[model samples]
Target: MSQKPSKSTAPEAENAAATRGTRLFLGLSCFLAGAAMMIIEICAYRLLAPFFGNSVYTWTALIGVILIAFSAGGYLGGHLADRKMALDLLGWLLSGSAVLTFFIPALHTVFAAGLSAQGLIAGPVIISLLLFAVPGILLGAVSPAAVRFYSLTLKDTHVGAAAGTISMLGSLGSFVGTFLSGFFLLSTFGVRSIFFGTAALLLVLAVAAFLLAKNTLRQQAPVILSGLFAFFMSWMTAPKPKPGVIFEHESFYHHIEVSERTDGDVTRRVLQLDSTMEGGMDAKTGDLILPYQQYWKLALLREPAKVGSALFIGAGAFGMPENVSREFPEAAVDVVEIDPQVIEVGRKFFKLDEHPRVKAHAGDARRYLLQSGGKKWDMIFGDAYNGIRQIPPHLATQEFYQQIADHLEPKGVFIMNIIAAITGPKAELTSGMLATVRKVFPHVEVFAVGYRRDETQNVILMASREDLKPLIQDRYVQQGSWQESLIKTHVPKGTVPHASYVFTDDHNPVDAIIARGLLE
Candidate 1:
């Protein structure tokens, strides 16, 4: 109390101000670091989808691997930050993650295709580890590093305040990042462009961190140069487009592609959703080219004596609707497809035209059926699927089959295209689907496309209110005449293994059933 403390000199005061400024930048880095982590996580699924499918298994593997990376990074990062300058560590981490993210667009296919060759069960796990682990670890380290740096800048050392503020900033950034990626970034800019943007943001943060570490602009120039160089190299390494692919896109739903291939006299244009061949037609005949679709011709032959109107769910390539419009020129046909881009692709490459009789609606098939008030069709077809292995669960339940039945005329028919095994280890999906459909429509029949009961193949299931067993007795219908050859593929109801359960909306395990089927 005898003497007052001396006031700080101008340089010391200026330095104190600089430290406060650096602390603010440190908080900004934490926010961005959180944003970067989420962006990478969301986009990572799209990276794997074109190959491994957007299955629940793929989702589980990615989430698990990323959490593991974050945990390890947090532990190691705290140790490093205690021993070294956190701002310096954060700078290095941001730079490293930036470089790795830069390379993702060019190199993801190589990793995905390689490990996916290992088969479905273990492939996604191994590939996710290889492709996502390091970037996640590096980005994960940023939080603790920033935490320590912020603590060092304070005089009283309020550890709880430092952590809470940093965590809140990161959490807020996470909320922003999730909405940004899901709502805007992916749908607008696409996945690869988002990755490029994320990389650039990280590079900027890296530079800011170094500059705040008392580094000269000259000292940080090389990092700027290296980031530039890496992007250029990565751009050069991007894979070339595949042959026969006329158009391609990353829709919110699937990686859709259209390609043309000729076999002998037939030139076929095919619409592929992910790895599944959902639609195709002959170039000249404009007729359906794939065999499964050929099964749809039974629509006109079997149930309705005359077709005036038809409703087709899941307009793959618009093949069936186009077929119906051509079959009965006066018939009004409505095709419902979930992906508008797929509908766009149908128009662009699949010859989906402006026919007055054919109307294409972009929306979910189930909702469309629910909204229909007293509208009935002579024939209703369900040609939708999630992939080769499974149908969309909501589309396969007893309630959905009831909707199909309710929307049909008294003599109308419902046809479903199913890819499943008949009587072997992988037969659960087929048994469950058949059992569920039979509950709503008493007359049920099936035709395995390849006529092999034990193998997984396209099984065309037919249901109607009218008795269909009589068709087998009709000579012309079964005479190997018009649709008689299709009769040869008939799967008698007794041959189908009885399932212990039926699929309902609340209890549907269609995806899980397929996953287990794949393992077997």
Candidate 2:
């Protein structure tokens, strides 16, 4: 019908398809490289987290250091490419990445413990910096080299288009890297596995580059050989956790550790969730005590007759769940935590397995809430974060509170704990939190659990549609629970009046608030 499409056009179309396919492949390779680099960067923090608290400063420093290294590498890569543009260089660079990745575990172990074992934290940092410098430099060089190689092959304007596309692909890979590592690998496979997984991806890229560059590009045997040799040496030095050690890892998410505890006749093991020591219990006795006893008081505050079901967002060691089960035998308790290793540790060492009434879901709290499908709760606990950062951004937002509100029954109470130090205008952080809750809940009541006169106090905020005055009066601090007993008597009364500030997703500056609190 179309005057018989020219036969020559068929071959042209096929050639176009082939070219698109090749470009697609190249883009994918670059994407994977980007992902692998990011994976290494994120996992490195997890490796260090057990030793260094996963502080905001630690994360910032790690990112800043890597970015600086990357910038230098990019400059060097571009200069080398301009001097001599060759696919072989790309292959060599990729091979180097693979070698560095494969050796990361060994290097990390040596850097973390080998030097620190001698009581020298500074020595470990120096060794780590040295070990990381080369790999970080090489990884940083990848993008610029890739851009140069692709740009040299393209026409004037195509160079700009290709560069933009490649950069976008790299960003996409970064997004995937963070999500996959956080939701899956870091939670299930542990930090070491994440390194190996990323390294394997780089190894595949290296092989692909080598094959494509052979014969078409100059010889790069020496670089490849050096990489292989380094990988082999590091493989030999890889550290292994000692046998009978139930669990051991470092991660940004949490300082992870679990060891089998055998004391007297009790053959069972105990789990320690963090260095901060939030969750732990007797493996055999399943006896929750002290600090845990304070957490258990929350369950008792619930209307005894009405508390039919409860949701514990961060059941670190399942101590709270165990206590809930013991006190409310008929209540259905659901625990949703991000880390499965934590649950495993709980079962192996924290007596989590002994509690038959509790059901555990291993996933992020948000994912759990969304998937649970309109299930109403009697009480929702917002004890998911440590005082280190007030609350996780996702959890502190107005939308999150709305979700919490959705999950609660008509008379249901939502309890949250926040650490704040000032009662004056400096109490903006507390005000912000109250303001966030006030957006949804009409009334917010904060009962100072510890000494109200102290500059720093742990205050329990209960938000509900119904009044909680009776509950706060009879069952809270005045009732003299184990929680109230720990409070210092000298609570500070601020001369300045409290300010009313709100924390919505759009305006909550928790980091700034935290900084101000520290300053005060």
Candidate 3:
């Protein structure tokens, strides 16, 4: 206290304090950036879902393209950081990303209409690349640049450790982002809100960047004006028009829409989003009508009492639930669908509101089943996928099927739809899936819908604990009111060929399966 501190010692101490603060700040920023990137990926899926029905091909293409884009951004960001580690550049980059984030919702309507005209392959591929590439590249640039800037500000001691700490935080943030997008953001905010929320977070990031660059900030006027312009332009624009009756709403997790032919005095309402037509309902009478009606007819082979309670995964258009409720009026029906907007659409467009016997739970089918506390069912229907893309991997897992097996009653039936290339070599996929089910269920059956026995394209799989051979015997002679009135009038054929292959979580190459069918 008596001796005044040396000038050299005082400056070093101050530098150490400043360095510690900057490192903490950089760690926080990196965390935010990682989360933002993941959110972008999740939202991209939501964006693509309407045009493509969550098919294996669609999921593969989307994810593969995103990974490629991220790789490209990594290269580009590293190059940019080498040239300049300025905090000003970092702020602008975040600001630019925010601008793009804000515009995505507005752009999606236009992009979808364009896809409809040009086709998803020719249109969506190009559109997604153009719209998303730059922002992705800019985002990729953030982590490297942040580390570089931190290196400049920090005292030379433990520079590598500090950079590593920031990197660790970023990775942790990414993990958090993946879960948050699915479990929290999508399920709570709806699609539009997620986009807007992402923009707000980016705005906060930009502000932080600006503060860090206070001493280095160049002409702030232009940056402020540019940001204002981007936001205004994005907010002022309206959604693009479509020819069909487009009904859009945010159901916590997804942007659900139902579009139909308005001019025709048709009784059917097409319940669709992206490419998956959840189901259809009679526009006039609100009666449930969908391809699933044919699937339900498979139950005709089972003992009537054995089919008492039913659990339907993916309660789209609520057609199956409504039909099941009508058939087994006393049955306790449990319907699990992830999208809340889909449920709302079911109520408004599909008369789900009037159906008192069915209870709809808005959550992922797998998580719900695992956590459903030993609730068993006589018939568990897994109608979880559609379109040329968008199939969720978790639902198609070996574990999920095992859970289905554990939850099913002794004489229960488990059915799921697999879009096969009904033609050529693709038939093996249907065969493979049948084989997979037979691995556990003892008996497996197939019903080729929208195609002839001779025609190969899309097929439905019906598996059972007991032999379907007995049901095959009664299929022709046995008569129920629904069987005689409904299925016999439509399918006419009492039985279809069963495929010999089984699909497991590890080996199910459904995309290649569809591609073989399509190419063949």
Error of 2 at 391 (Å): 2.7
Q: Once model 2 is optimally superposed onto the true structure by TM-score, how far is the C-alpha of residue 105 displaced, in angstroms?
A: 4.4
lDDT of each residue in 1-520, candidate 3, tens digit only: 4998687998889878866776677777788878988887776777776664455544555666667777787776667877976677777778888778777767775666566444434445665676677677777777777777677775446669757876788899899988999778776776766877787788777877777667434555555566666666766765554556568765544556676653365566786665556677777765655554557657756767335788999876777778788878888888999877677777777778787989999888988988998889888888876544435656765667888999998888887876664434545565556556667777766666664554544466777778776665456643665545433323222233355444566766655554444445
Clashing pairs in model 1? none
The number of the candidate with the highest lDDT is 1
User: Once model 3 is optimally superposed onto the true structure by TM-score, how far is the C-alpha of residue 338 displaced, in angstroms?
Assistant: 3.7
In candidate 1 the C-alpha lDDT for residue 78 amounts to 87
**Tens-digit per-residue lDDT, 298-326, candidate 2:** 43554554467889888756776777778
Write one digit per residue (lDDT tens) for candidate 1, span 195-281: 889999999999888877777888788788878887887788766777998887887777788899898888899888877888888
> What is the lDDT, from 0 to 100, of the residue 420 in candidate 3?
60
Clash count, candidate 3: 20
User: Better model by TM-score, 1 or 2?
Assistant: 1
Clashes of 2: 8
